[model samples]
Target: MSVQKPADPESEWLRQARAGDTSAFDQLVKPFRRRLHTHCYRMLGSPFDADDALQETLLAAWRGLGSFEARSSPGTWLTSIATRICLRMIAKRPRRLTSGDRAAPLRSTAELGEPVEGAVWLEPLPDGELADDDDPAAILLRRESIGLGFVAMLQQLPGLQRAVLLLREVLGYSAAETADMLGTSVASANSALQRSRQTMRARTDIGEKKPVDPQGLERLLQAFVAAWESRDIAAMVELLSDDVRFTMPPLPAWFDGRAFVGQFFAERVFQTPWRLEPLRGNGQPGFACYIRQAGDDRFRPGGVVLLSFAGGRISAIDSFIDPVVCRRFGMRDEIG
Candidate 1:
């Protein structure tokens, strides 16, 4: 007697999805959501923009499913759609930039110029939002790809070059696969990758250096948290690199050098009582800051700060102080 064979899960989902089963479509695409969201964030450099692009990609996928030839896996197909959507978004919107990227550092922290309008600053992705991939290589890839420094450098590249570099180097797509996704020839994709690498090298030491030891990084972060919570500006200064940078984005002002950053912290940042809840984001150590206002006992959400390390010291402190940013990071409005 012949026995019936079980249906392939992907094939079954594809059939249901094509037949307009929204649940099936959701299930079919669930496995790729986190990676695709990360891809969008890497391409756009803003979590909000990434959210929009991912929604657009999913909508496009739903409408175009009938044309999906199944030549590649669903993930590959979704990624192609996402890449195109991001390219369009990139063309229309201004490239996101860090405060340091906008202009020279300010000499004083007396006044943080009003939040810069019409500019999109790079945003951080909460580590919790990342995929639950246990593979060592996948973890490494996410670490290298989603770091704020790397994403900022990627923003400097033209759209095609950025896409090529991400697809080929970070995502591990073959040259031919990248070309097919971007609708170009393999030679062109290779050329874009070469140019992208050159630009990235010119901007920062992205792939050349080794990461600081985890134990040391933990110690540094712990010291920073203690100093910050205790309002010990001097102690905080001790953990900064000689050329440390302090930037509070949306505020056009940034400070360079440990002396200047320390002064800013003492005079501007620690003027109010504060508490920090340690967290990680953008492949770096950070925290959610809650501030106690004058005459108020309750601590309210203040901001999110992500730190970059160099030579066992804090090299850069990128703070997002907007209430909206705080909310997006899922910090409670009141931490008391």
Candidate 2:
């Protein structure tokens, strides 16, 4: 009897890729890219950083493919590599506050138009990125996790804690699985998960979970744009909830409630002639604010503002004035 050898799984494709078959490698990697990016984003909290880490992870996976035994699925292997890369990056970076950490406290509707400053701005994830068909629950979980508050809370944890919490809670990895990914004891992983949960619970009002109505949100946002463009202070004030919160980050100050917002806008923001160019942002309503140069009516890009709505009213307004942030949001120096 002759003994026949079994064909190697992935051997054909591997050979093709090794021979510079770009298409084959792309085919193998295409499906995982978005999910990998989402994972990296959760770990890093910065889309830019996630892109960088993803590049590194893919390159590492490609280079190390020879040793990738089929013991684990390709997705699992990629996730493990990406997780390690993010962990290393996080360890090197200085700790900063998450967007939620700096979220302005809720205020009454009368404070709606305040010109508050000095909070680190939190940008929203693109709607397309958040709307996943494969896993609805996971998508919602991811959205909530990426909220300014959640990101801020994440920043409070140590690098490893952040990774563990993201893996266990956000990604739904079990304790043993996370232990394997992070190369820690299961007990250590569990401990990190517990600590992360406790910190998040302590910092945020977890019980205040409110559902966002997308259509209603859009209506409120459209009204805001119309009012602001028309400089209708009354209209703008009318759209704000009684306890709307206004904060702009990288500055420490924030204004709570509508009266301060009204005072700030009436006294300062509306004092200047400005134009707003509408833009979609953070899966919600947004605008590019432009200031009309003195003696001229033409509006030059001033900054970007992204609105967050809660309970049918604008609750949080994130203003990004940094030139770098403007570039990231795909805004030009001038919008005509």
Candidate 3:
């Protein structure tokens, strides 16, 4: 079929887009962009990878417009294209393994490893990107879907199996549709889905965190920010659960238990006077942490700290040491 397949009821913009109209192409893809990006993020477990995959998918869709058969809906078609792009990306890159489980005890920050060079760790998505709409209440995605805990669990599955589980389970696609997207038979898709579900069940805690009060969220965030900036290890320790997890990506150490973590912070973290800028990430409260040394004129970007909450307590803190993640939070390089 030519680009001029006008009767293709799927995308009015598709017909114009096929006829070399750039605006029509923009119209055709804008509706799917955010969702497509999220899909890629789910499959790949990194926002940067998702951005690259989405761009590649759109480029592929643009070039392949002449082959657009309107048998499937536009969203499905875009999803099919995007999923394949992520699959290819996954094939080419090394998946960032979570080292928290295998990590040596984090006795001190002196032992923290250098950034593993490339994307060698699971990264987070800004919760702001979860929904296309500005009003968060209107968004339909579950907290579990975008949570770092869940995304890290997703990283353990094989790429296609991950795609199958995401498509069939999370995205609400039928087995047949998921199979089509994966270029596999329905039986294979269902088998993969079963295996993925079993693996996830065995490896990860699948319970979703219950919703918290917005005012409570903000209050806790403000308190945590104050506590952090004050460099009061005691105050910061009070905000954490007894079993809270502290993980810094690209560094192979994770500390568990409030007393150990509290002691670690008191001895290591509080040594540097910090300036924290509050932010949001992975649908949770986050901070852009800056450190001021004795002679430092301004506080420089040290890391991005992401906090996950459960039952009115901070349950987890993922501090990304990678500078790219810091930039993704859209903060200035230094705080004066």
Number of backbone collisions per candidate, in order? 0, 27, 0
lDDT of each structure?
A: 0.89, 0.69, 0.81
Give the per-residue lDDT digits (tens) of candidate 1, residues 1-336.
Answer: 999998999889999999999999999999999889999999999888999999999999999999999999999999999999999999999999989778899888887888886547988888888888889988877888888889999999999999999998988899999999999999999999999999998885553257778888888888998999899988999999998888887888999999999999998889999999988888777999999999998999888998887787888888988777788888997867
- Candidate 3 lDDT over 100-217, as tens digits, reads 6446666555566655566778887877787556555445364667778888888888988899988987778999889887889999999998999899889845333476678988
lDDT of 1 at 88: 98
Worst 10-residue lDDT window for candidate 1 reads: 203-212
- Estimate the overall C-alpha local distance difference test score of candidate 1: 0.89
Which segments of model 2 are wrong by more than 4 Å? 1-15, 18-23, 98-124, 128-138, 206-208, 250-253, 277-282
> 1 or 3: which has the higher lDDT?
1
Residue-level lDDT of model 2, residues 1-336, one tens digit each, is 999886554556656666677777777777788788877776776666778999999999888877777576677788889999998988887555433354554333334344433222334444445435557776566657766556656767788899998888877788888898889999999998888888887884421267557676667777887887778889988887776655554444456677766655666677777777677544345787887766865677667786766666777666766555566667666654
RMSD of 2: 5.0
Clashing pairs in 1: none
Clashes of 1: 0
- Global lDDT of model 2: 0.69
Model 1: runs farther than 4 Å from truth? 206-208
